[model samples]
Target: MNSFPVTKFYDSGKVHTTDTYYELLQLIDTKNIAFEVPKMGQKLPFDSVLGVQVLNVDSKASDNNDASIVLKAKYGKVSFLLTGDADVAIENTMLPKYDLKSTYLKAGHHGSNTSSSSNFINEVYPMGTVLSYGKDNSYGHPHKEVVSRLTTVKSKIYSTAVSGDVTVTTNGQAHSVSAKAWTPPTTTPTPPSAGTTGKLQVVKKDLSTEIVSIQNVGTTDVAMAGWKLVSVQGNQSFTFPTYTLKAGANVHVTSGPNAKSGGNYLKWTTANIWLNSGDPAKLYDSKGALIHEVK
Candidate 1:
């Protein structure tokens, strides 16, 4: 199992002890497999492997996305961005430091809105986007908004959700996507609008910073008084102040010692309230009616 060098960016103590990692460690001494914890800006020593390169691994961020390793590989003139579930914050940090433009992009976070932000998508300008997710996932992988974002760039999108076991072949000059079950959707589905009430849209959530945004997309202003935003994982609740969210407006909420309320932002004033993965945000009206939920 430890045939090749293993590179990890995070501290060993931070990870829950897993049988897989433990077994790998055992092999290091016996098999002489190299182990390394690469730094953020270090270039992986893969120069002999042609154009494959590890662009960045931002382990400093206190989010799961930071563990994601962004890789770039080229064959002839074609290049691919294999994003391992990196979210928006990681993408933003990489934008200013790396040449992210590519011919193909493996959409981050399984096409979650938190990863394929508009700015990152625009900067990558991929000719094709490959979404890796299971079919009919409970978390709604390959979210409609993310799909729309890629389409706007005129990029051909292929999803494992529909196209099982997708495969892409690339030479230095070109690339192609192929899967026996893959077929373009006859008609694309439209994403839900932000202007819908009782449907508080979770626009952004930064677990590293504990910042979240919810928008009021309804045509009329909606009074947010008594409305509550709850972190399903930690059971943390943020009660809305006496404020009315105007149509097409959104509010930003943060958690920490610097929690403050002003204008369109609210603070939760806590720590470790939001889970980095697989946690839902539930919204309820003053009357205790469940309004919206997102994971």
Candidate 2:
């Protein structure tokens, strides 16, 4: 665990917290994680807090979302501002209270117009802004006005609804984006060419063991590199490493706690994925064509 304190800056005064919050606090207590309450202008220890610095926390008390903890984090020269559902009222309260400029901004309240006010946008002038809202959500977040405001300032915008998730890698000063956009397969899986072994089968999938075994039933070798194994129910995928399956050979893709990687055993992850009730698995080739599926 990184030696950073998980700070809590808000608590209900007149409106008490829900039972869910009590349960969450209990879970945090069970984990032995250090939780703290912070004050303004207190910077966390630079060495142990994952290079993040604390700028300000709302000094006044509130019973609504405005009580959310707002923070700034930096790695080398790159900086980020994260506003947790804090609305425009909180933004205005913080404007003159702290140094709010940032390289990237996770727009408040999922880019709703209630937050990201023109005054605040003009103050930060972030290089890139992210709007995080579900696709076809009921509220229709990322309101057009907010997008227009960011555009007016020429800040590059990214949305999780458009791109499933956008990844950012920065060397402190410079940054790059890798979009994890999903697209459907255009054509069905086709048969292998003549004299080439094109057949494979998911012979077994055991939730108890968290392993999916695939056998090459064909007479030719099948390249497994770039292949993907997907959990249909969970909607999670794992890409295979560089390897090839010879004729009549089999490989086991394992997940969960007992997973181990080797020549014939490939570890997909260390977390439990297979459903206890029931789940299906799908195999896709490098060309995005379906190879096989098993329950």
lDDT of 2: 0.72
Task: Give the lDDT of residue 172 in candidate 1.
Answer: 61
lDDT score of residue 276 within candidate 2: 56
What tens digits encode model 1's per-residue C-alpha lDDT throughout 229-294? Answer: 887654446777666778789999887545566788776664446776556888877666788887
Q: What TM-score do all the candidates reach, one by one?
A: 0.58, 0.53
* Global lDDT of each candidate: 0.70, 0.72
Output the number of the TM-score-best candidate: 1
Q: Write the per-residue lDDT of candidate 2 for residues 78-160, one digit (tens) a residue.
A: 88888867778878888998778888888988877778999999988898887888775423466677887888888888888
> Which residue pairs come into collision in candidate 1?
75-171, 75-172, 76-172, 77-172, 85-109, 194-217, 195-217, 195-218
- Where model 1 places Cα greater than 4 Å from the true spot, the runs are 1-14, 17-32, 47-49, 180-295
In terms of lDDT, the poorest run of 10 residues in model 2 is 9-18
Cα miss at 32, model 2 (Å)?
Answer: 1.7
